[model samples]
Target: MNGTATHRTVIIVGSGPTGLLLAGDLATAGVPVTLLEKRSHDISNLSRAFGVHARTLEQLDARGLADQLLATGDTITGLRAFDRLTLDLTTLESRFPFMLITPQYEVERLLERRAREAGVDFAYESEVVGLRQDADGVELEVRGADGTVAVRRAAYVVGADGHHSAVRREIGLDFPGVSVIKSLFLADVRLAERPEDVLTVNGAGDCFAMIASFGDGWYRVMGWDRHHEVADDVPIDLDEVKDVARRALGSDYGMHDARWLSRFHSDERQAPRYRVGRVFLAGDAAHIHSPAGGQGMNTGLQDAANLSWKLAAAVQGWAPDGLLDTYETERHPVGKAVLRSSGGLVRLARAQSPALRAVRALVSAVGNTVGPARRKALGQISGIGYRYPALRGAHRLTGTRVPDVALAGGRLHEALRGGRFVLITPDPQAYEDPGTRKDRLTVECWASGRRTTVLVRPDGYVAWAADAPDATAIEEAVAAAVG
Candidate 1:
C-alpha cells in the first residue's frame, strides 16, 4: 500500500472501551473522530475485566446502552468477604445499584455499535507508528493493512491505548509504579458447585481466591499459587489451574471445561498527569492497577467520559485552556487513590501468616458490624467515593455527581446527552439573554421547585448551584463555567 493523508477533528488510538466511548461522545458532540484500531477483526469474546459499577452504569445509561448491557450481563448485589459475609450492595440505592458483570469484549462491542450510530469513523487494522505535535494540531504516522503507510492530522489526539500505549510514549509521559511481587491466575470455567450466596474471596494458607458468577454455567475465578509458575511457552493446563483453585479454597472444588486461562502480574502505575499538551491519555494508558475491586474497565470508561467533553469544548473554542487542565486535576487524584486501594487490597488478600489471617478476620468482622465502615468499603469498590476539590461554593450539590432528577418533560440526563454545558435555572429569564447564547453556550430553563439554579458540566458533575433566590449570583457561576 502507498501513502495517504486524512484529517479529522480528533484521532483516537485504540478501539477498546475507552477509545470507543470517547469516539462516540465526541461524534455525538458533532466532532469528527477517527478511531484507529490495531486489530483487524471485531473482538467478540474477550473476558478480561467484567465488573461495571453503579457509577459506570449511570454513565452508560446516559449514552442509551445501559438497557442492552443489563440484558446480557449478570447483576451482582455486592462483594462477599472470606466466608458467609455478603456486603448487600443492593442497599446502595443507585438506579443501577447492582454491579453488572459482563466481559470487557461485550462492553467494547456495545460502545463500537453506539459509536458507529453516531457516525464515528473507524480505521481498523491500523497501528499508530509515530506522532508529532505541531503548533496547531497533531500529525500521526499510521501503518495500515498490507504494510501501507499513511499520515493523518487531527486537532487533538487521545491515547486510549492500553498500558503500552504508543501515544503516551510519543508524548514522553512517564508511567511510574511498582509491579506486584506475586503473580495471580485468572480462569473462566464451569464450576460443579452451585451458585454461591455471594461472590467469594477466600483466605487460605499461601493463597487467596476471588470468584464471580457469570452468564451461562461459567464462573470467573482468580487466585494466587506460590507453587505455580506461569510459562508463556506452554498453554495453561485446566488440571494445573484446577489444582491451584483447590489449594486456594482449601477444598477440592470440581472445576471443569476451562474456557479461558491466563496469569497476570499487577502494576499500580499511572501517568503523572493525564494531559500532555494537545495529546491526552485515558484508561489503561493513564493508569493501570491490580483487578482487586473489579474497577479496571469501569475506571477507564469514566476517564473517557471525563475527557471527551473537554475535547469537545476545545474543538468548539468555548472552553478556556484552563478548563482542559481540570481533567488532570480531577482525574489524577482518583487514579492515585485507585492504585493505593488496589495495592492495599492485594496485600490484604495475600497476607498468609496465622496472626495476619486472624487480624484480617477480626477487622472484616468489625467493619461489617458498623454502618459507616460498610458504606466506606462499598464506596471504595463502587467508585462513588470520588469528590473533586475544584468544585466549591454555595451550590448544595457542588462537587457531587448530578443526580438523575426528573424534570417537567423528561429526565435531567436527556438535556445533557448532547455534550454541552447545561444551565438549569428556576427562572429561565436570567440566562435567556441573547448574549449568553452567542458562543455555543446552551441554557435550558427548568423549574426545580426551588429558588436555586444548577449548572452541570457534560461529564455530569455540578459546576455550580445557587441555594438562595438571587438569580444574579447563579448567573455569574453559570457564566464563568460556560465561558
Candidate 2:
C-alpha cells in the first residue's frame, strides 16, 4: 500500500513548540510518534515569540518543565497596554501568576529534550510533500534532506506546523483570514538609556512601539509606523525601529547597535476545522493571531495541550466515543476568541479618530473600573479562564479549568505528569474499590477539607465533578471518561 509505507502511531508535521510539545506528550504516554521537521536538528537562536503566558507555563508545569523555563526567564507580574491600561497578572488563581519573557527557542529546547528522551522518532530535515487518508489510517509522502522521498503511514496525522502549513494544504483545509498589521518591525538592540518602566509601550498619532529587556544586555524593540506603511518585503533597518520608537515611545531609551532586525506582517487566521477524519491540526497550523497581547504562541501551545492526551487515548484504544471530535469542538472556539481579542487589541492600538478614540476610552475605562471585565481580560491574555463546553445536566464545574490545588501527594499539575485523568476526591477510602482503578486514570485525595469531588482531564480541565461523595457515580463517570 502506497509503496511500502513505514507505519507509526502518529506523524506530527512541524517541530515548533506545538509539534515538540505534542510529540513529547505522545512519546511520554508510550505512543509511537514520528516528528517530521523540515529544519535540521540544530537549534535556532532567533525567536519571534518572547512572552510565555501563565496558562502555558501551567501546561509546562504539568509536563515537569515549567520550573526550568521560569528560572531562566524574566517575570513581569503586570502587562501594560495602550500606555494607560494595565492587566494585573498577579491576581490570576494559577501558580504562574506572571508572564515569562523568554525566547521561543528556549521552549523548543526543553520540549525537544523531553521528546528525545521520551523516544520520539525525530525526522529532521524531512518535509511533508503529500498526504492522503482513508477510513483506516492516514498516509504521508515525506521528503528528506536527501533527494529521496519516503512513504509513511500513521493511525493519525497532526499538523503542528507553522502558518504556511503544507499539511493543511495537503488536507485541503483553508486558512481563511487577513493580515491585521502591516510593516511591523522588531530588533534586538542595546539601549543607551533605561526607560521609565521595565516594559515600555507608547504610541503617538503616527507610530506605536514597545520595549522590553531580554535579561541579556540586549533589548527587544518592536515598532509600527502608520504613516510609512510598506509591504512586508521591504527591508527594515535599525533606523526604522529607532524612528518609530522615538515617535511613539518618546526616545526608545536612546536605542542603537541592533543585533537583529526584520520587517513582517501579522495575521488573524484560523482553520475552519481542526480535525479531518484521521488527520488533525494544532498550534499555528490550526490558528494564528496578532501578537498584540503576545497570544500567538501561547494559544498554539494550549491547542497542543488540549489535543495531546486525546490522541494518546485514541492510540491506546481506551478513548471514549467521539473523543477525537472533541479536539475541534473545544479548541476551535478558543482559536476564534483569540483572533477576536488580539484583533481588537490591534484595532484599539491604531484608534485615532474621535469614534475610535471613544471606543478605546471605553475599553480602558471598563478595564480599570470594572473588576469582572478586568479579570476577563487577564484570563483571556494569560489563557486561564477558558473552559470547554459541557453537556446538559453536567456538574456546574464540568468543563471549567481546575486549579492546582494541594493534593495529599503533591500539586494537581504534578499528578498530571503521567498524562492521565486525575480524580480528586475527599473520600479516598471510597475510591479504594478495585472498580475505580483504570490504567488511564489517577486518583488523588485532597490535602484540605474539600467537599467537591472533581475529575480533571490530563490537560487540567474538569471533565466531571460532584459536590456529593457518591462513589458509585464517580466510578461510572470514570469508566465513561477514560474507557
Q: Estimate each model's TM-score.
A: 0.90, 0.96
Best by TM-score: 2
Worst 10 residues of 2 by lDDT: 1-10
Runs in model 2 lying further than 4 Å from the true structure: 1-8, 433-438
Query: In candidate 1, what are the lDDT values of residues 157-259, reduced to their tens digit?
Result: 9999999999999898889998864467778888787545336567666667766666766778877676554543455667766666676665435788887
lDDT of 1: 0.78
Residues 1-483 of candidate 2 have per-residue lDDT tens digits of 223233438889999999999999998998888899998887775678889998999999999999999876688899877857889888999899989988788899999999999988888889899999998799899888887899889999999889999999999999999999877887888988977655777888878898877777678888888888788778888877887888886785777788788888888889999999999999989988888899988998998999999998888788889999999999999999999999999999898789988889889989988999999999999999899999999989999998889999999999999988898999777675465345677889999998889989999999999899577888798888977
RMSD of 1: 3.1
User: Per-residue error at 34 for model 2, in Å?
Assistant: 0.7
Tell me the deviation in Å of residue 82 in model 1. Answer: 4.3
Error of 1 at 81 (Å): 3.6
Candidate 1: 10-residue stretch with minimal lDDT: 1-10
